[model samples]
Every structure is written in C-alpha cells, then in structure tokens.
Target: MLVLGLQGSPRRKSNTFILLDRFLQEARTKGCQTFMLEVCRKQILPCKELVICEKNGECPLLDDMHDQIYTLLRRADVVVMATPIFFYNVPAQLKALIDRTQTLWARKYRLALTDPKRSFRKGFVLAQGATRGKNLFEGLQLTTKYFFDAIGATPAGNLYYWKIEKPGDMAAHPTFSEDVRKAAADLLDPLVRRRRVLFVDRDGAGLAPMAWAFCQIHAGDRIDADFAGIAPAGTLRPFLETAMTAKGIDMGFFRPQSINELAPSFSPQQVVALGADVMETVASRFEKDPVEMTCWELPTFDTQDSEQISRLCKAIEEKVQESFGMA
Candidate 1:
C-alpha cells in the first residue's frame, strides 16, 4: 500500500510537520511505501474557475497540478493531510491544492469515469490548533469530508490536537507516541487484511488488465486484485479502453506493470495466468510463500474487430466471476 502525506504548514519545521512526519514514519514501519509532499513548497496555483475541468474533464493549468499531483492523488491507497488550523480551516496554500482537486471531482462526477482504486482508497486528517476552542476542528473536518469525496477516498480518521502552537509543542503532548501508533494501526490494518489476487499475461497489454478490472468490479470488497505481465508492453493494448467504456467502466488510469517489477514487493495469495508462457514465467520467478496458481487458455483474435474485443471481455469477466465469487 502507498501512504501519501500532504504537509500543509508553510514552515517546514512547524508542529504540523513534526506530527505528519512521525505519522508517516509509523506507516513506513508497517511495510507501506510512504511519501510526504510539502504543499506550501510546491508550485500549485489556485484554481482559476476555468470550467474546463467540468466541460472536458481536463485541467488547463500547465503546472505541477497537471504534471504530477493528479496522478499521485489517483494512485494513492491512503492519503493523509496534515495541517495547522488557520482560522478554523486550512492554510491558503493547502486550500489551493484542495481547490485544484476540482479537476478530479469533475472527472468522476461530470465525465462519469471511475478510478480502479476508488473503492478502497482511504483519506485522513491531522490538525493542530493554538487555541482550546470547542469548535477548533469543525470547519476543517467539514471541508475535509467533502475533499475526501471529491478524491474518491472515504474519510477514515482525524487526529486533532489543541493548544499546540510552538515548534515543539506537539511532541510534548501526553500520549503523543501512543496516539500515532494506534491511529496508524487503525487506518492500515484493514487494508492488509483483504485477500490478494494477481493476474498475469504475456504483455499485460490486454488480457491481464481486463481480468483484474473485472475481478475488482465484481468482488473488490473481498479481494485486492492486481495485474502485471511477464514482459510488460508498457501500455494497454489498442481498443482496450473502448471495450471497457462500452461496459460503463473507465480504463484511462490503468497502466501495465511488470511481474519482475512488482514481485519484489507484492506477494499474492492467488495467481491467474492468461497463458502457459505467463504461467511458466510466474512459476520460475515468484519466490513468495505458498501461492495458488491457475492458467487460462488464450484465443487468437484480430484487435481491430470490435466483436472480437467484446467476446474477449466477456470471456475474461466470466473467468473472473468463476474464480472469485461474484459480488
């Protein structure tokens, strides 16, 4: 799992940063890949209300928001936003980043596209306030809830600290270490509990991605479905997106991965190979403990023919349903 932390403090060494850094460190110890983006240091500009995102599902702004942030938001399994309460809300720089997520909201709500990981992605908040006001976190929590929806992540947890202002104030709080440990466990344990299933193909250009998507669409709650190729083609096959779109599924965010690249980190409880070549490759390469493997027969077809593509999708969906029980 990937845990992405958005540090919202303008000062790099502020109490907000310290709290976020410690939380991310705990996540790393749990075998998670963690990344922290200092939002105040980035070149993220405020949303200009261009309406281009609502109309075309694309942001016209040519900055870091377009280049990198959008992909990170979409790919992250867990997103943690750490901020100091500025007038009961968030800092302007962090608010700008939230505003830019309007593009992501537009993509999902207006264009009706679905991110494959949307179903399981989680969002969290960590906030600190200088005052002991009763409503210290009210506005922040409300805005964050909507922000989580816009990004396709369910609001999982919020850790709020009051009367914390100075540089080292947060660290001096009672239960600082215990709170971080418990919160990290509560957020991450359930994610790792799901059954892991992997789908493999010759190139991951077509068959494996299709099977992976179908498995998720049908049984995402019970299975964590992953797809890769023996020798990745580095992209999806032609007509793959169109085939998925016809079934009301979006394949725009899907990317081909290599088994050799993912095997080092991901160990699957179940493996499904599209052909004998892929099965052989997986058997020889995967050194993980006790995995169940199954091979599916592949049929020759012309990629240009729509009918052939439709049949292939149906075949893959049936196989997925048979292997992993239908939702």
Candidate 2:
C-alpha cells in the first residue's frame, strides 16, 4: 500500500511535523510505501475563486500543486494531512493545496468523471493546536472532510493534539506517539491483508459487472473484485442485472464506474479486462504494476441477443472459476 503524508506546518520541526512523521513511520513499519511532502516548503497557489476548474476540470493557476502534489495525491492509497492550527483552522499553505483539489471535485461532480481506484482509498487528519479551546479543531476538521472528499478518499481517522505549542512539545506528550501509531495501524490494517482485482470494459454497463458478480459469489472471501468502465455510461445494464439474477446473483450495487482518472489509489493488483480495448485503457492509466496487467482472449458477445448474453455469462463464470484455482 502507498501512504502519502502531507505536512502543513510552516514552522521547522514543529509539533505538527513530528505528529505526521510518527504516523508515517508507523505506517512504514507495517510494510507500506510511504512518501512525505512538506506543503509549506512547496509553492501552492491559493484558489482565486475564478471557477475555471469547475468548468475546465483543470486549475488555471500554475504551481507545485499541478506539477507535484496532485500526482502524490493520486498515487496514494492512504493520505494523511497534518497541520498546525492557524486561527482555528489549517495553515495557509495546506489550505492552498486543499483548494486546488477543486479540479478533482469538478471532474467528478461536474464532468461526471469517476476515479476507478476511489473505492478503497482512505484519508486521515493529524492536527495540533496551541490552545485547548472548545472549538480549536472544529473548523479544520470540517475543511479536512471536504478536502478528502474532493480527492475521492473517505476520512477514516484523525489525531488532534491540544495545548502543544513548542517545537518538541508533541514528543513530550505521553499519549501523542501512541495515538499516531494506533491511527496509522487502524488506517492501514485492511489494505495489507487482501489482494484486489478490478474488471474493466468499454462501459461498466456490460461484461465487467458480470465478471465481478460471478467472482463475488464464488470467491468473495479470497480477493477484492470490482468493475469499472473506460467511459462510464452512468447507468446499470438492466439486462445484465436480470441475467445475473437468473443465475441467483443479485447485482443491485453494480453501478457504472469510470476507469481511474489518475493511477488508482488501489494499486494495479490484477485487472481483468473484457477485451483488448479495456486492457489498453488500463495500461495507459497504470504503468507501475506491469506484472498484474494481462489480457485474456475471448470471443465478444452481443448484448442485444439473449442467447449470446447467457453464453457470455457462462464463459465469464468459467474464467472466474479458473482465476480462483490460479489464486
């Protein structure tokens, strides 16, 4: 698993930095690949409220956010954003990075683009404040929530330290390190256990979901399997759903999913593409995990014909069973 930790403290060696470092260190010990980026050290342009991203799906401002931070965010399975409280919220630099994610938000909600790797990604916040006021962390927590959402990650955990002002103050706090370690483990434990598989098709409307449903019924416990489309049609295929039900598999949750915009947060574990087009699409998106990217040659089935659809399902079932034996 890839864990990306973003430190948002302007002060060198501040409590917030220490908190993030400790959390990432624990994640590393759990056998995860960890990357730490200090946001204050990077030039992140603030949102000008130009609304360009909402329209174009790209930020108008040019800075480190586009060149570096966005790539880091896209590749990470678990993201940790840590910052010192600034006026009851996150520091300005970190806020800049968060604001720049409006592009990602626009792509999903406005352009209807979905990141295929989104389902497994998780996020966490580690913040520290000098004061112990009742609302010290409230504003920052809410901002972090939306920030995580924009990046297509669930806000799964947090560690907020109060009354830590000095550079080394967090280190002296008896419970701080323990809290960080526990939070990292809680966030990473699931990712370390199971191998994941993603099925791809021209539109998530067809064979991808069929393969997913069949595998889920047969070997759901052994692997994580999901389906996505190169271009999402935005609706479930009613016929495929009916066909699955006839086989005693209910695909109520098989909604159309787009292939990941960036390399998936779920690393390229195993991608089962319905045809060469789907395999090529997955290849273009993810070049890091080449070993798991393989194509199987199979005859295409016509969705309009009911007989061919049953034959297609039967073929998928056989392939899925073969995969189980291979695993």
Candidate 3:
C-alpha cells in the first residue's frame, strides 16, 4: 500500500510535522510505501476558476502543482493531511491545492468518469492546535471530507490534538506514539492480508492495469492487485486508457510508479511478468522460493493495435484467474 502525507505546517519540525512523520514511520514499519509532500514549501497557486478542467478533464494551469502534486494524489492508496490548525481550518496553501482538484470532481460527476482508485482508497487528517476550541477541527474536517471525495478517497479517520503549543508538545503526550502505532496497524492489517500485489513493467502498462481491473471485478473479495513499472513511464498511453474505459475501468487517475519502492512492501505469492524484459527484472529484484512467474509477449499500448490490446487483456485475465486458482 502507498500512503501520501501532505504536511501543511509552515514551521518545519513543528508539532504537526512531527506527528505526521511519526504516523508515516509507523505506516512504513507496517509495510507501506510512504511519501510526504511539504505543501508550505511548494508553489501552489490558488484556483483561478478556470473551467477548462471541467470541459477537458484537466486543469489549464502550468505550474509545479499540476505537474507534480496532482498525479501523486491520484496514485496514493491512502492520503493523510497533517496541518496545525490555522484559524480553525487548513493552511491556505493546502486549501488552494484542494480547490484545484475541482477538475477531478468535474470529471467524476459531470463527465461520468470514475477513478478506479476511489473504490478502495482511504484518507485521513492529522491536526494540532494550541487552543482547545471545540470547533477547531470542525471546519478542517468538513473541507477534508469534500477534498477526499473529489480525489476518490473515503475519509477514514483523523488524529487531532489540542493545547500543543510548544515545538515538542506532542512528544510529551502520554499516548501519542502508542496511538499512532495502533492507527498504522489498523490501516495496514486489512490491506496486507487481503490485497494481491501486481509488479509490472512499462511494457505491461497496457496489460497490467487491465488484469488488475479484472481481478478486482471478479475476485476482489479474495484479491487486491496493484501495478508498478521497473522503468516507469510519464503517463499511461491514451489508447490504453481508452481501451480500459471500454471495459468499465476508469484510467483517468492512472500513473506510473517505481517498482523499487513497491516491491519491498509486496512479497507477492504470484508474479506475472508480461514480457521477457519484465520477467528478468522481477527475477533479479525478488529471489524467493520460486513463485509462479508467467511470461507473456504483450506489447505496450504504444506498439499494439486495438485488436491486439483486446486479445492481450483477455489472455492476461485468464492467466490471473489461473494463478489465483480461480480457473
């Protein structure tokens, strides 16, 4: 599982960051790949109310936020926003990024495009405040609810603390560390036991995501599959997305990720390598007691025709069913 943490505290090493770091560390210990984006340090411009995203399913903005942060939110299985309460709400920078995701909201409701990641992804909040106002966390929670909805995640839970005025106040809290450890375990245990991991390559982009969808659709209760590439690409090929959409799998939120970061978390019982290149890469990276590795000569969306992609997806689905002992 991948967890993306948005650290919204302007003060580095503040209580909020410390709490978020601890939470992420705990998540990592439970075999989650964690990424933290310091929102205060990034240049995230407020939404300009440009409706281009509503029409084309993309924002017109050409900034770091669009290029870097947008895809990160889409790819994460779990998203955590950690912020020190600023006037009972989130920091302006993080709020701005939240507003920009109107594009995703539009895509889902207006254009009838569903992000497949939404079905299983989870979201949370971690906030700290010096004052003990009852409503301090209310505004942030509501905003986060809408934000998480737009980004295709369920608002699973949160961690909030009051009267944490000093830098290390959270450190002194009696149950801070223990609570975080428990929370991490709560999030990971279900995922580790139930989810099936899919390690793929750039060549398998066309096949891997489709196979994952099939597994999710047919055997989701018994299996959870994820895809990653050895030599990751910039984005999913447009035709591949189109092909998957035909099968009712939304590919709008698809993005390539490094296998190095994913492999450690998923000691897969079965590995499907789509091509010779992928087979070799997986073999070198993972050395265990010979899990079944099936190789297919499936060309990527870039090289394959429409008919080829269709045939390959069907073949991949068959192999997946066989591997899981469902066939």
User: What is the lDDT of every predicted structure here?
Assistant: 0.85, 0.77, 0.77
What is candidate 3's CA lDDT for residue 264?
67
Candidate 2: give the clashing pairs.
116-260
Best by lDDT: 1
C-alpha lDDT (0 to 100) for residue 246 of candidate 3: 66
What is candidate 1's lDDT per residue for 22-50, written digit by digit as tens? 99999878766678998998899899999
Which one wins on TM-score?
1
Which of the predicted structures, 1 or 3, would earn the higher lDDT when compared with the native? Answer: 1
RMSD of 2: 9.0
Tell me the lDDT of candidate 3.
Answer: 0.77
Name the better of 2 and 3 by TM-score.
3
TM-score of each: 0.89, 0.65, 0.87
Candidate 3 similarity to native, TM-score: 0.87
Model 2 error, position 94 (Å): 0.6
Better of 1 and 2 by TM-score: 1
